[model samples]
Each structure stands twice: as structure tokens, then as C-alpha cells.
Target: MAAARDRGVRLGRPPAALPEGAPRAAELRAAGNSLAQIAAALNAEQVATPSGRGQWTKSSVQYVLTRYDQERADDG
Candidate 1:
């Protein structure tokens, strides 16, 4: 581990990156959109999901919102 660190190798899994639509999703939610509505809007806009596959679902939107919130909190 020390040798790898000295060689500039990163340890452990990479940090999670927010999806491209994450901020938009958070904004929509802040604008009082329901989870389903947010999902529909995202799908209509053809935004890529975190997985880069499949359409946005209410659950997925909620997950992204939660993660986005966590990231914001951490940053602040």
C-alpha cells in the first residue's frame, strides 16, 4: 500500500460522481415537483441517468436527489 501510494496510485473505489442531471433534478424538486413529475420531466428531456441506461423512475429520482443532497451537505 505504501509503495502504491508513493507511485501515485489511488486506493479503494473511486469517489461517486453526480450525474449530469443531478442538479436539474434537485432544482425541480426544490420547485415543488413530485418525484414522478421530476422523473417524467427528466425522461422528456432525454437526460442520461446515473447508470447511463434506462428511463428515470420515481425511485431513481429520489435516490439521485438524496445523493445530491448529501454531496451538497458535505461540501458546505
Candidate 2:
């Protein structure tokens, strides 16, 4: 069990929200930061995942962007 834990097995929080800060992320995009760039920044900041991962899985980033678009559409 100890060995398994040492093997990068996470046994804590589910993981952090997938590259959150939707508004912040969108702002970065509008300011010319690419999606990859935003992800990198979030990772660099050590954003936690619900599963306790330290990075995003791409799809997560896309999810945030999609949500933001939907929100804007609804607001207008």
C-alpha cells in the first residue's frame, strides 16, 4: 500500500476544478493568451484538481470556454 501511494497514486480530494477562473481565463484569451497558455499558467500556479491532479486534461479547458460562451449567449 505504501509503495502504491509512492507511485503517484492520489488518495485525497477528487481533483481541482478543471482550469477554473473562467472569467479570468476568458480575459486572458481576449488579451491574446492562447488556450494552451492559459492552461500552462493555471498549472504553474499549482491549481488543484478534484482528484488532486496538478494539471488540466485539455478537455477541461474546452469545457470552461464552452460554458463561458453559453453564459454570454444567455445574458444577451
Candidate 3:
């Protein structure tokens, strides 16, 4: 473990990444759109969800936004 750490190898599940529409969702949210509205807009734009199989839901939007915020906070 020490050797791996010295080699800069991260040894756990990788951090969650923002999905394709995450930035747009953040933008819509910053513009005061509700989570439902953001999800609908993402659907209207045919943006793929993180899973790339299902439609965007309010919960998914919230998840993406929370992940996005966490990433930003970590970066700063």
C-alpha cells in the first residue's frame, strides 16, 4: 500500500464524474429553473442521463447537481 501510494496509484472506487448534460443542468439551475424543469429540458434536448438509458428525473437532476457542486468544491 505504501509503495502504491508512492507510485500515485489511487486504490479505491474512482470519483464520480459529471455526466454529459451536467454543465447544462448547472446552468439551468443557476438561472433559477426548478429541478423538474431542468429534467424536462434535458429530455427535450435528448441529453443522455448518467446511465445513458433512462430519461432525466428530478432526483437525477438533483444528483447531478450535487455531484457537480462537490467536484467544484474539491477543485477549489
TM-score of each: 0.79, 0.57, 0.80
Output the worst ten-in-a-row residue range by lDDT, candidate 2.
14-23
* Residue runs of model 1 more than 4 Å from their true location after superposition: 1-15
Which candidate would rank higher by TM-score, 1 or 2? 1
Name the regions of candidate 2 deviating beyond 4 angstroms.
1-20, 47-54
The lDDT-based order of candidates, best leading, equals 1, 3, 2
lDDT tens readout by residue for model 2, 1-76: 6887999887777633434467766776788877788777767766653346657546655677777777789789
| Model 3 regions lying over 4 Å from their true place | 1-12
Residues 8-63 of candidate 3 have per-residue lDDT tens digits of: 99998986667989999999999999999999999999999998888999999999
Evaluate candidate 3 by giving its C-alpha RMSD to the native, one decimal. 3.5
- Residue 6, candidate 3: how far off, in angstroms? 20
lDDT of 3: 0.94
Candidate 2: lDDT of 35?
78
For every model shown, the clashing-pair count is 0, 9, 0
Residue 32, model 2: Cα distance from true site in angstroms: 1.3
